[model samples]
Target chain A: MEKKKTTIILFSGDYDKAMAAYIIANGAAAYDHEVTIFHTFWGLNALRKDENIEVKKGFMEKMFAKMMPRGADKMGLSKMHFAGMGPKMIKDVMKKHNAVPLPQLIEMAQEQDIKLVACTMTMDLLGLKEVELLDNIEYAGVAAYLADAEDGNVNLFI
Target chain B: MEKKKTTIILFSGDYDKAMAAYIIANGAAAYDHEVTIFHTFWGLNALRKDENIEVKKGFMEKMFAKMMPRGADKMGLSKMHFAGMGPKMIKDVMKKHNAVPLPQLIEMAQEQDIKLVACTMTMDLLGLKEVELLDNIEYAGVAAYLADAEDGNVNLFI
Candidate 1:
């Protein structure tokens, strides 16, 4: 069978959504297909090893955060403060569920020849220097993502 | 404790997403919180009592359609076209799942006093007349969704 190339343009600033992109892109890799994920805006946070992700919280956010054991970790809320139930719950879930960290997932994608692109505009707007970002990301402009998107691959906004 | 209201924007034109929105809104209603689902774009398609959702070909998107069930229906690419394996899988998995249907979920939200807002911009773009939509949908614009989302409440876009 002839191999088909499909690129996915994921646009999202939401932490939970960035996590979703990682999951979906990883799943695509398992299928032995060419997968490219474009991360922009809020998505850039996922590529950082720095603990800077911040999800705004109020009474409900705090209350809701407590009820869920794994909190944002299991719920795919990457930007959640202290991961809902804090680092312990997140570590526990990661071990028990075999959930891969976002960074590790990117590594796996790289091993599988998956192309990872980061939006340059978002980086500039957010004041993210190349030195600040992780090693695996490719910086580009709208034309880069749009070119892939127009190829009829897949354009997704998370 | 004072009760807070949140606007949950459900931007789905797909059958399954509409269904997910209804179920999620229903879940939020269980918390006795006010929920508003703003349906716009392709999401308007689900409100129509007519037409079947399609799940496109390809294993991943189809599997996603089958797994998510509601989000994929809008594509109209049911798995049945493939010797019945796909559709049957979708049905079997759906049986064990407990998500509410789009219509019923909407009713549950309304009965529980959850607000429903439909996007007028999307309606115009899709050439959908107000009469073509479901009865409970309140049509508005981006300004409306933003206005509702402004209250520092839990905001979700599904």
Candidate 2:
């Protein structure tokens, strides 16, 4: 029998939203499913390396890069932001509950061999360069995403 | 052959995100796939009735009801909110492009027989009553969502 396939389109930059996506993906992978997270738009911020990488860029690209979060740890919460207090509070609660952080979750996903693909189109639009993102991730477009999703048992756009 | 299934977890309350969810759901329905949109968390705001419906509620619930958008039209954008300018700008662009608004896309989904489900758990947490939401929609929990999603050809959390 073929393994079940799960494809998720991570489209949000929110810390909580990305956590939810990663949690679900990790759970699905634990169930022995072939999981893929196609990071797009703001979601690609989760794959960033948390440091500025000097690269040539136009004004708009530079603006976008400066405005967007540098990495998953820098992402804000989707709700109750409360002037940047929410993420800190959630982090405290997560630590108390022994829950893994978003960065660790991504590491686990990688260790489990879950495929992580960054959307090349959004990369250009957002001005994110290959060197700025984490290593060992594939880059592709919507056509490749649709190909994975069309045959997927579980396809989610997060 | 069994019909292909598409299930979405509409978890965001943003106007643009909800529009994306409805558009995808409507498209899947048009393709003859059985589709379900499980509205959870802030996503339930889309199903709210435009008019105020007086209902008994605790303090927290009342606060939730008051803070959340009354309906789809009242919801804000996820990005570039610009102190309420974003939604208006997007609506203007949508009008210029002859693009369907989120509310109409929802109506199209219903007409195409796409199942719209409100997550009962979140509804209760948010203090939303049955009379407050649009008519002809189903109310269910995560179990039902999982049942549909486990075999879903396309499952999205938008």
Candidate 3:
């Protein structure tokens, strides 16, 4: 079967886009197509091991401040969004829906063989050390995204 | 007066991002700032009057598909990552998080004077009609995004 080559470039870290990017990548995987997701800027947070990220208060806030993992305890989706409710509400929803949090989502992506790439330039500019990123994450540049996009992968700046 | 400019782009139909966009825009509005959202690709579905989405089946499948809108009823969210229960669980979590659904988020965006722009190129390529889009949605080109983005206002893609 001729598979559709697709690449989703996520330039965001917001929850909705993060979810959309994941869902789209999953759809591609389900279709048995080659898929790659390039995360940059706010998008880089998607590849982090952390969940329950707290958005910065405002301008001048450090990049990936809350998004970055504080440690294994705070890393890897330890906190799912309560959608603004307390942690208890977030947990309740998890129990009710049986939805896999971000960490699980990343695991599922890896298990499904979906490729995850991070933007090296953005990471460097933001002063992120590779060690600070998730273990499974791949680092690349615009050339990499272009290379994939040129392969007829659907390029999206999410 | 130097008005605060906030332009958030929505690229998927996921409830969380839509809700964030809504909340951020509303937040800006509350501060009397100008807010706008440019919707494209899957994000267009959020504005569709008839965006009736459905969840994918299977534990892995459902978890992966959780970020997508099953329909208008499931649009916008105050929560994220149902913690692996499923869509229903995700929704329950969303409710706990105080996340608004997509439709209500759209309504909120408008009520707060947030401009809604749809990417014309994407709509045509996707075979969508104006009717499929929500009312008051403006049709724009890449130039529009560039214009907005170049202005140095808060321009975010999703």
On DockQ, the stronger of 1 and 2 is 2
Consecutive 10-residue window with the lowest summed lDDT within model 2 chain B: B119-128
Task: List each candidate's DockQ score.
Answer: 0.03, 0.26, 0.07
Higher-lDDT candidate of 2 and 3: 2
Q: Is candidate 1 or candidate 3 better by lDDT?
A: 3
| Candidate 2 lDDT over residue span B1-158, tens digit each | 99999999888999999999998899999899999999987799999999999999876567667778999999999899998999999999999999999989988998999999998755765568999999999999755776688788777778
Candidate 3 segments whose C-alpha is farther than 4 A from its true place: A51-83, A86-94, B1-158
Score every model by TM-score. Answer: 0.43, 0.63, 0.45
Give candidates' CA RMSD values in order.
19.0, 5.9, 14.4
Identify the candidate with maximal TM-score: 2
- Which digits, one per residue and each the tens of the lDDT, describe model 2 over residues A57-150? 9999999999999999999988767677667866765664476889999999999898999999999988899999999999999999999877
The TM-score of the first chain in every model comes to 0.68, 0.98, 0.72
**Minimal lDDT window, size 10, model 2 chain A:** A89-98
What do the candidate models score in CA lDDT, each in turn?
A: 0.55, 0.87, 0.61
